[model samples]
Target: MPASRNKKNLQVQRSDHTTIWYTVSGPAEGPTLVLIHGWACNRGDFDAVTDHLPANYRVLAIDLAEHGESRSTRDVWTMEEFARDVAAVLEAESVDTAVVAGHSLGGAVAVEVGRLLPDNVSHVVALDSLTYLSLFPAQSQEQTAAMVHMFREDFAAGVRGLVEGGSPAGFDSALKNSYFEKMVAVRQPAGLRSIEGLVHWDMDAALRETKQPITVFAVRAFATQEAIDRYGDRFDIVLVDLGSHHFPVEAPEGTAKLLASVTTE
Candidate 1:
């Protein structure tokens, strides 16, 4: 059981013409765990979590289409599309039952997957994510539409604002600037459309229907109070004390511990 970082496996091509790149590691007889990264993040985002996992458990991490090495899709990407892409990844790997772990946008997709693939999915974990997109309050159609337009076209600027100047978390200024650069560099029309699609997706039906055991971790000092408060008893909440919005990068070990705890039950 040595650290296995460079063991990438395959590219999963889904029905919508979106090719998802993924990696599988761990043991042959171990439990299967699927890790899904947030918007604009690739599978390598989970390197820390995967490294922390037991050598006896199988883990799969995939780059959502339009992010990382995966190709963009023809369809307007919604959370459902993202969830389906994940389900396809698990099935392709011959994983009959698994613990699904997601972060940020992937957390939302994990909810959809728990609802859609209940039988095969054993449990779910959402780290540093909100249960619903409505956590960010809005005033009118004008504001929502404006936000959507920004996310659809000028998303790099939007993400830049999240990390630039004022919003810098407890993290180092240099690290914050570096992440902002990477997130902004991944922008595209398809990525923008996907962000807008996620913004508009109604999660009421899925959240209410989700009965799986869920774990939600938040960096409140990074994410606002509104984001953490939304989980409540609806999910098993674990708040990490760091202020980095980019928890996967700034605190991968702590993130992995919380994720592994969700499977302990």
Candidate 2:
């Protein structure tokens, strides 16, 4: 186990009628590293990663609205709104410049963060994210409906499919069950609606608007060749032999090293 570090829980009120919760660690004056958890995940996902990060790097792990400790009454669940949740935390922390790193859906939020605060966010990092061709690119109406229908009809099954899809062959069934249970129990309405929002997000437009050096640490087993070929010129996709889509939790030391590599560069 990694040594424990002191963390401060904080909240920021957003203009969009949401209160965002986040955790701050490391030195106060160190270079900022904003950590955004993926859909259905909370800031605790990065606790081990933070422990492995350099002592001089300031870390902010955020729980987006309606996830974890964060609460919101807003109805809009767009990727841009998720980015605003992050922006609220950055504003509260007074982060002048930082490398914004996110996992899964949070990866899209990181890109929007770069777009929202072009001057403050210097680099964007994605952990096993932004590789799904169906989700990232604009999907046809029928395609979007079909994807959303799965979650609407059987939420638990939809969550299970996500875990199974991300896991490699011979992966532990126990871990898969654990992931499925946790994700299936996500705060309702928001959990289902967020998936809808992700399906409709236009990654091509977001990429065009957000101009930042992006480094995607994609899992070798989950990432598709088509996704790599399409976004190859746009992003620095580094194929990692990590555990799975949730590799950040499974391999915190390796994840920290990947995030640190970009921060130091």
lDDT of 2: 0.91
Q: Which lDDT tens digits does candidate 1 get at residues 127-241?
A: 6676334422222577668878666566778877656532443547788777777777774766676667666666656777887887777665554555546547577766676
lDDT of 2 by residue, 119-216 (tens): 99999998888988877777999999999999999998888889998899999899888888788888978999999999999989999988899999
- Candidate 2's TM-score reads 0.98
Evaluate all candidate structures by whole-model CA lDDT and list the values in order.
0.73, 0.91
TM-scores, each model vs. reference? 0.88, 0.98
Best by lDDT: 2
> Model 2, stretches more than 4 Å misplaced?
none
